[model samples]
Target: MHWLRGMWAAARSGVRLQPHHLCAPRLVLRATAGLALAGFAGYWLFGLAAGVLAMFGGFMTGITTFQRSWRPDPVVPLVCALTMGATTFVGYLTSGSLPLFLTAAAVWTFLGGLCWSLGANSGPIALNNIVILLITVTLPNSFDHALGQAAFLTAGSLIQVVLVMFPPNERWQWHRTVLASALTAEADYARGLKDNNTVHFTPDSFLQAREADTLSPWQAAHQPAGLRGVRGPAEEIRPILASLADPAATGPDTDLSRRQARELLDTAATVLDAVAHAVRQGARVALPPDTAAALAHPQAATVPADPAPRAATHLRTLLHDLIEAANSPRPGRESTDPVRPPIPEQLRQAVRTLRGELRHDSPVLRHSLRSTVVVVAGYLIGHNLPLGHGYWVAMVAVLIMRPDFAQTYGRVASRFTGNLIGVTLASLTLALAHPNELVTGLLIIGCGGLVFLFMETGYAAVQAAGSTYCILGLGLAGESWSDAMPARFALTLLGGLLAMAAYALYPAWETSLLRERLAEWIEANLHYAAAVIHQYAEPAERTALRTRDAVVAARTARLAWEQALVRAADEPVRHRGLPPATAAAAGQAIKEAARITMLLEGNLPQSGTAPVPASSPLATALRQSAREAAESVRNNRAPTWEPVRQALADWNTPNPQEKALHHAGTLLSNALDDITTALDATALDTTAPDMQGTR
Candidate 1:
């Protein structure tokens, strides 16, 4: 019990490394030395049988199978292991030949690929094990030799995991902080996009915001059960984005003001991104120049650095008041003025018609499927080549080929460049000293530690190259470390070419499905906004509605952006015209809508209660005008601001609420005009004959 407690304390202590305090070089050296010693000791004491198994097992565990945000059920790992083990066992029983073993291994690889597409966490690792088992069983080798290798590998994996669990609790904290910072930066970026008014109605900005939003939710979900806390910061941020996306709030006339707001948001977003990056690299967050300026600005300085804290306090107070209100149980009183009947059938039909056209599916999915198929085919072909070590090349291809060619191509170029540098260094190391089993083990540990420390940085390819060198140095398949470089480089190049070819071809059909889907999503969101605004009778209801709207808008925007990429993949010719829109615009619209809805909800009198009125005629006129504007928008009619203008003309109006309502009405009318114009423009451009097939 004491030993267990001690181990727990050590683990906890190790988790506390500050982002900037991690000593990368020392950590790498220590990890390398530890793993090397463990590998050798395991081989000597337990023999190679267990060691080899453990090493392969660890390697399998290290391979990433799913996207970062995916979270599978806890039982998934068990299921994956069972499936992998059972298939291997069956293969061994049915056919005891090398060729048969290779075939089974290939099948296992395909299954792993499928699992990846289906979003499985351990799929790649499971596939690696299957390959290892096949190789061990089929190779003409002594039983003792195979057993020894397996034992050593297993020991290596165990040691690697142990080495990773070291003292430095600050490191973990930094890592978490980094993630949070990235999300924050993304939010700010979205804000900036809206402020710029660069295609305010497009999906580009929304997608980026969605990505950030997704990360936030995932982090919340992944928090350990007992330690889980409320996500108040994200909740507050949600309204800001919602407000941005609300077409009934943000107007073209206020573009300059919106831009200023965006600048502030972008500053905050960059701060967050920097923080996340710093944590991952074991560094501190460094604010950019513009970010510094915004923070220092006199007017913006009043905005809380931590909006979540203020929101949480406010929410708590509001809830308490609500609870008291509920407890007191005020008696219901009849209203002097009767409620209006339901809207006219003609108006309802018109609203339905407008919504139906907007709700049509986008053409993005078809294009995505085509591109995905091409990439997958290329990967299979590259891996299945007659060359001895072509699979590594195939792996590289998988990492580099993205739907967005520019980004994917850049990553591929960087990866290759980094790999070349890493391989050269590894070759020199091998030449300097014959990489014995001990050296090989040390290298693996060293690579693992580097990966662990710098996984957050944009240098994953370099880390992969280091890991590759260590793996090859182990003298597997009678291959010498010194001679492997030339073949490895050639194979990697071939894989890249194949991937490029696949990207260039594969889509035989052209359609605007992606665009249609995006438009539909936007239309659906608009309808949702209308419903929420119309039903804004209570504060609690408004808050819930706002949150839902923000989330949905973010998600839809992300989908639209992703679809656009997919569309570009299928129709490269159209890529130049359909530039990615900033996610901030959509976020801003959503945020604005949320804010207004909240205001309306807050202003609503309690059940059977009437709002206090001003004695002045100007106040009465302003209130009436606001109500008319709201009604007009709800009825899908063009809102006229003549009444609002007349009300505003009276400068000495004494009623604050009336003045507020008049201003709100004016803003709403402007927003409606901007939205209508944007929609018309989008419809015209998208429906053009040449652009019809792009989406």
Candidate 2:
């Protein structure tokens, strides 16, 4: 019953096409041109059969080119073309024997699934090759015919790859866009802070920006100054801004410190916007007059002397670096693009990743196992059925199923609904027009264009366009509407149901790991807070670096927990250990604690400054509590903060110089108590066991 409800929920969420304006018209036209040229040329040279195969070859290769990555656009398509050519030829050779072909295909599918261990980009490329293999194997041909077909298909893919390689000569275009977006997001966050609004600062753009830093050898030699080292300071600004505007650190809205903080934040926003605009436009940075003046004399508007930081001093320094980096002169543009890190480095990294995923607990391993078994089972069932085009069943499954439950189920619903609309429309068109080869070829090209145009709109839209395109291409090969449409529709449903059922039987639900995620986050936050508190006890370069590393780990853990919550939201299974309200409350509490720690971190004393000995016990207590609280969280028990409170109470009265540290200690003690209370107020149900586990 839970499984049925889960499927229903996934289907309902999937069919709702939340449209966005993110289309790539230029790329679509280029891809479509590749498809049209090969399709028409093949028809002219060989025959209608060659034209259909060539069209599919060109289109699937175009799909590979659409995957966004830091790699040169031609690299993925070229590799995929080679892989597809080899697999297609092999599949054709083995098609005469069912057992031999099925065995070969199962091996291919398993390896393809494991390709995810290499990277996100590798998975799609492998999937495209697998799809081609599945379709090609069903069509047994003589050696000559098979060789010619593979040649034509490879030729079509090469055509697309050539087109991609010759893109407009704007070096580091993708890198510039992502870096600019990260700066723009930071600018917005700063403005929101100035306005005292709750801003949701996500690391997604920054993460993408970091990925953009992976440059090819040619790019590395001639990388623009703006692209070289701007992201580090930009990333550091997020936490500092969060700390600067925190009311706990800067006092209430009516205070002079709060007003000063707002002014500095506004100036920070202006500086960030200037840097972002320069990166986006490939021009020199031009800071506003007021922003320049603010940076010139940051101390005039610094925060209150004690307890609060003079964050503007550090903020101005970072802003200067950002401007300098963005304004650095551009290198002369070169057309040469060497492979990034060469091929050897990429292969070594892939090997390392695959080795790591070979363990039993790895999600990639589990998913690969599931995909291999389901795809092979789908193939066997579809082939033995009375339906003529049995490959459609396996093809549908390949197109829909994904590693994660949400994506797999979402795609199942989207693909089935999309195929329904597409098959019906194409069937109706064939029944009415009864078009000839030339007209069918034109229609096929048109459908291909539609697919790419709406590619980013949603999966449902892409599938709708893609299904229509496939049906028209089949028409070019002499398949009638009656033979193609009804069978395809039935098989699409069967494939989706099969995928859903397979997932249900061997599910990898993220919901089961909610408690684990929370525990990791709690431990990380406490460790980071302790690091910051220790800096007050004994400030040093080592402690400063350690604090930096600890904060980064805490941020990563927080992001992991947030992602887990999203993945678990629509999953069928429930976390019996942690209720929804309890999880939210506890997460919020930890977030607040992190924020308080960041506030202290921004105002740390310089090395050789007077050490606050009283903070030592509090720091030690925090370090000890981190280990214990983490264990308590995992066991579904309320964590105690008595050690932190006891350390604060037993300490001697602070001198005037150490009052700020003492006050910060009191704040820390209160924050820890809030976490304890959040857990203690909510009872752990533990009425049922966890559904599943994932790493």
For candidate 1, lDDT tens digit of each residue in 359-461? 2131122223333443345445644776555345545555554434443444555555656766666666667766776566556555655554444444434
Candidate 2 structure quality by residue, lDDT tens digits, 543-568: 87788678668877888899888888
User: Which stretches of model 1 miss by more than 4 angstroms?
Assistant: 1-38, 45-53, 60-230, 233-387, 390-393, 399-408, 459-464, 467-477, 507-517, 538-572, 575-672, 686-695
Q: What is the TM-score of each candidate against the true structure?
A: 0.55, 0.88
Whole-model lDDT for model 2 versus the true structure? Answer: 0.78
Q: Judging by lDDT against the true structure, name the best candidate.
A: 2
lDDT of each: 0.42, 0.78
Could you tell me how far off, in angstroms, the CA of residue 684 lies in candidate 1 after the best superposition? 2.6
CA lDDT, candidate 1, residue 442: 59
